[model samples]
Target: MKNAIVTGGGGGLGKSICTELSKNGYAVAVLDLKIKDAQRTSEGLENASAYAVDVRDHSSVIEFYKNYGKAPELIVNNAGIARFNKLLDQKIKDFEDVIQTNLIGSFIFASEGVRLMIKEAKKGSIINITSIHSVSPGIGVGAYSPAKAGLASLTKLMALEWGEFGIRVNAIAPGFIDSGMSKPFFENPKIRELRGKAVPLQRLGTSEDIAKTVLYLSSDAASYVNANEIIVDGGVIHSVLMHLPRE
Candidate 1:
């Protein structure tokens, strides 16, 4: 069975990804900062295990592999944090924290996953979960946009450099998904309705929506696809012009 590691695989979209991957026949390792949360996510999934890992900490991530005993062929760099504040009001430390976890953290895990794959001589896939903000920055999202933008660029670079080894690197840019950190915000009926109406699909995206995309990218169906960013925003990002006055 193919082994896959999903960082932040404890709840929300990460948990959904774990469920989808497990259904697709991959032995999954659910890595999260909170072991209990990871365990909760892995429960009832055959061949799925949980490990506590802080993606921003190099030593912590390294320790996971040291204890895991087997290399993973597929990695989903989905761990991230976000802070909402204006650029001017956002603290330098807060901004850096977001960048470290969202951008640098993905880099650390992806690099380690690649090393393991190369050692095992396994053709692997690395999927990074980026946000639609990477292309369309929102107000008061200080560091998130830049971090995701950097991650997207890094995905391309890795794909370009590692394609020779048959390592595929790509990203999914999800817009307004109702999961993880954004769940609380969407819980507000007013905000929820507004967000739903804003999308061209006239509906909010569910965690399963993103999970299905991940499964596709990880499967042989996408064997020839690499160095690409799939936008799963229901055409919301492209609907800005439609918001203007129309005859």
Candidate 2:
């Protein structure tokens, strides 16, 4: 069985990715900071197990991989956190914390995962979960935008460097997904409606929406595809000009 690891696999898009991967016949390791949350996501899935890991801590990540026993053929860098505050109000520590978790954390996991894959002589896929904010900066999200943007760049760099090893690295930038850290805000009807209308598809994205794309990228269907960022935003990025007032 192919092994797959998903960081931040406790809930939202992470959970959905785990489910989809499991369905596709992968034995998934659901890694999250909270063991209970990871267990919750792993409960009903076949061949799925939970592990507690803080991606920012290299030791923690390495320990989890040691215990995993199986070298993963697929690694999803989906763990991240958001700090919403204007640049003036944001603390230096908070900004650093965001980068630590979202950007550097991904670096740690990818490095470790690739090491294992190379050692095992496996051709693997590494998928990083970036965001539309990485392309278009969002207000009050001072740290998130730059962190994801850096992650996107790192995705391409990893792909370029790892291609010789038969490893493919890519990213998925989700927009207005009704999951993860954004769930509660989308629960507000007014905001949900407004956001839905703004999307060209006339609806907000779901965790499954992102998961399907992840499945595709990780499969052999994309064997030759690499160093690309697939934006799963229902055309929101390209439709932004439609919102402007016209004469």
lDDT of 1: 0.92
Q: Put down candidate 2 lDDT per residue, 1-247, tens digits, no spaces.
A: 9889999999799999999999999999999999999999999999999999999999998898899876689999999999999999999999999999999999999999899888896689999999999899999997999999999999999999999999999999999999989999888999999999999999999999999999999998999999999999999989969999999
Question: Model 2 misses residue 165 by how many Å?
Answer: 0.2
lDDT for position 35 in model 1: 93
Q: What is the C-alpha RMSD of each candidate to the true structure, in Å?
A: 0.9, 0.9
| Candidate 1 lDDT by residue in tens digits, 114-164 | 888888866899999999999888899999999999999999999999898
> Could you tell me every candidate's TM-score relative to the true structure?
0.98, 0.98
Top-lDDT structure, candidate number: 2
Going through the candidates in the order shown, the clash numbers are 0, 0
Query: Model 2 lDDT vs. the true structure?
Result: 0.95
Off by over 4 Å in 2: none
